[model samples]
Target: MVVGEFTQDVDVVVIGAGPGGYVAAIRAAQLGKKVVVVEKDEVGGVCLNRGCIPSKALISAAHHYEIMTHASNIGIQAEGISIDYGKVQEWKESVVKKLTDGVSSLFKGNKVERVKGEAIFVNEKEIRVVSGYEGSRYRFNHCIIATGSRPIELKPFPYGGRIISSTEALSLKEIPKTMMVIGGGYIGIELGQTYAKLGTKVTVIEGLDSILPGFEAEMSRLVTRNLKKLGVEVYTNAMAKEAKQTDHDITVTFTTRNNEEKQITADYVLVTVGRRPNTDEIGLDAINMKMTDKGLIEIDHQCKTSVPNVYAIGDIVPGPALAHKASYEGKVAAETIAGHPSAIDYKAIPAVVFSDPEIASVGLNETEAKEQGLKVITGKFPYAANGRSLSMNAGDAGFVKLVANQETGLLLGGQVVGPEASNLIAEIGLAIEMGATLEDIALTIHAHPTLGEMVMEAAEGALGQAIHQINRQIK
Candidate 1:
């Protein structure tokens, strides 16, 4: 049968209804523009459907299980604690469904049209969306591309049989007895620790000298210590050579720091080295769009592509591939499309890793500041001294480190590694964005017996006026 051709016109058409794409669509609609979103699969994309939400859900469950099994010191004895992983996955899927359904409802409430299909560019102002046997063309005044990214699979360890990616790991029906993680980045470490807490023998092989090379060595050291406590083996300065799979298990060969080759066999192998942009199959060249050698789209501060009527955001653009960062870029792109003069400013974007003890950071660290030729003063406060951390049975968990200007006392950056580090990094991020100084945070009286007081204590320590701990004034 021959298909008929029809074209629909809209004010804006957003491709890939991920966090970035959906946010862009809703915001464009809210700004009085008729918007239509085209997605190949689910509305919430990978972050809601697979990556962020599901991973965090599993992590929370694993954390609870770990705490219950080891809380005898706190007068709570949980004998014979067992995990029903199938039910855990069911609960995880329920959480995902609620959020994705909420996104669908928002699209309806905002009157943003959603077309389910794979989209290809016909030109800057026109696109064709095909779903199964039917195809439709869309003509728009403006377009935003937010297709996001997928995990990178190494040639030696293609994803099949015993070899898996994060997506497959999250949806596993049964927990593996043993697992091997290929990389030691946030994704690998996060999932590795999650399974370890749930009673799996885990091994991590990192090409760099340390896991999470993006963070400070001190912060990474804290996570390494926690991983050891969980009985997880970590190999830094190691290179993965190959993977061979059998009917029963998979074996991975790698070279160690001493240039010795070693092998480990496990029920499954997870490769989470990094993510590659989803730019190749979208027909970007049809519109002559500009892209980097790394396959990232080149866009201005306003998220405008080389094509005047086209724009891009999120993981497709250069920066850390974070869901929050993508959502922020979406808003900026939509506001700019609405003629609101919004531009991207990433001075205070925070990055968080939900490890055993979480690690979060924003802006520059001491080494970065010094490399940039800025004289910096540093302040450090431990969770051991905080009343809240001590009461919470995590006194020796982690600490807060603050970096400030030596002469002006301006807060430049901060790093937190411990319980609730993910939530605690926000205050420091706000301070950096608001141009708050050391005195600004220290002078503000924080409530007593709270974890947040550590921020103030750190600031006071920088000023040589710390009351809870010995003050070492930065000369």
Candidate 2:
């Protein structure tokens, strides 16, 4: 162990260098506050180095490979198509490295001190930073906890050679011939599809009645169809009983919801059950910070924790474990710290799934709206009728659904399950945030031959004025 002492004070100290923590530091610095970000790992955290960027890079490669293999359908004759997994892995690493370096540069540009150490709360306003090479103690006027979360590893399958976590799955040296994904959530499906596209015999085991348990049944059904198209075998309401590793392969024993047991063999197994908050080793108890039953730090609208002069944001607090959600919360916390009355609008935060035909949604869904006792009306437009989707050969799978207040016509929520759904959902999020009525969206003049036009058409459909589809004759 190495020890060094450096005395310095900052207006704000952010723990963790993930999306939320870095964004908070930058925003605080922009507000003319002296900020320092403490990180024990890479500057970009899991989103850039391990999770989002890496996974997307792999998916992009797989998508290209799949398209190239089927080039004959598009009037292009191609032969001798092959994939070099080594090159793909190298390219992905290069992208991650460039982005990580860019983030470090941003910290320098913002004049925020980047400390490479693990921070433990010594008190409300003090922390001890211990590093592998150097150790120091720091003091601050205000602190933000953006420590993020970690993947929950199941006891039956420990992460090693055969059974692995998403982090390891992303860094595989070669695409396994047979793979088993042990989860049905967004992460499992996303990676499972990517591997299947890359020529892996991928099977997904989800311990729920449906894959995306929290999403609407219709949306989940559509996604399941798409997965089947990619040649992925999905087992819903199936629990993995045990994993046995042999010299040649790994066998996973699972039990179905009906109490029938089965076995499957695979070269690799990915466990993407879920993530848990990283509050265990942060010394939150020492600072007397209040946490919920799930161990998430309790915060108000402004992200203020129970301890005075301390705040929390991102996955450490409540809400979805999305990077953008955390980033927005970080900005709000920073602005509030700078004496700028800033509050977060949780209703407008869009959640996106980067699957084949993607999924995106925001605000209240049908069940939530009904549970709230609001009089709601829903409108849907299938992509099968859209011109651009047909041109892209992606028209058959999904549709866009919009929910509005029956009397006021005010947009309440939006859900999409089609190509570029993630991108199209942003418009609805903005509209909902601005409190736009159905007519406001219907008259917004969406461009022709684009996915965004569907938003307008859906809104118009709700108002009984859609041009492409037959109007619903309302009594």
Off by over 4 Å in 1: none
Per-residue lDDT tens digits of candidate 1, residues 1-475? 3166589999999999999999999999999999999999898999999899999999999999988998997898778889999999999999999999999999999999999888999988899988888889999999999999999989999999999999999999999999999999999999999999999999999999999988999999999999999899999999999988999999999999999999999999999999999999889989999999999999999999999989999999999999999999999999999999899999899999999789999989889999999999888899999999998899998999899999999999999989999999999999999999999999998998998999999999989999999877457
lDDT of 2 by residue, 242-354 (tens): 99998778999998888899999999999999999999998888998999999899999899999979999998898889999999999999999999999987998888888
Runs off by more than 4 Å, candidate 2: none
**How many backbone clashes can be found in candidate 2?**
0
Q: Estimate each model's TM-score.
A: 0.99, 0.98
| lDDT at position 248, candidate 2 | 71
Task: Note the residue pairs that clash in candidate 1.
Answer: none
Q: Pick the candidate with the highest TM-score.
A: 1
| Full-model lDDT, candidate 2 | 0.90
Cα error, residue 310 of model 2, in Å, equals: 0.9
lDDT of 2 at 169: 93
True-vs-predicted CA distance for residue 227, candidate 2, Å: 1.4
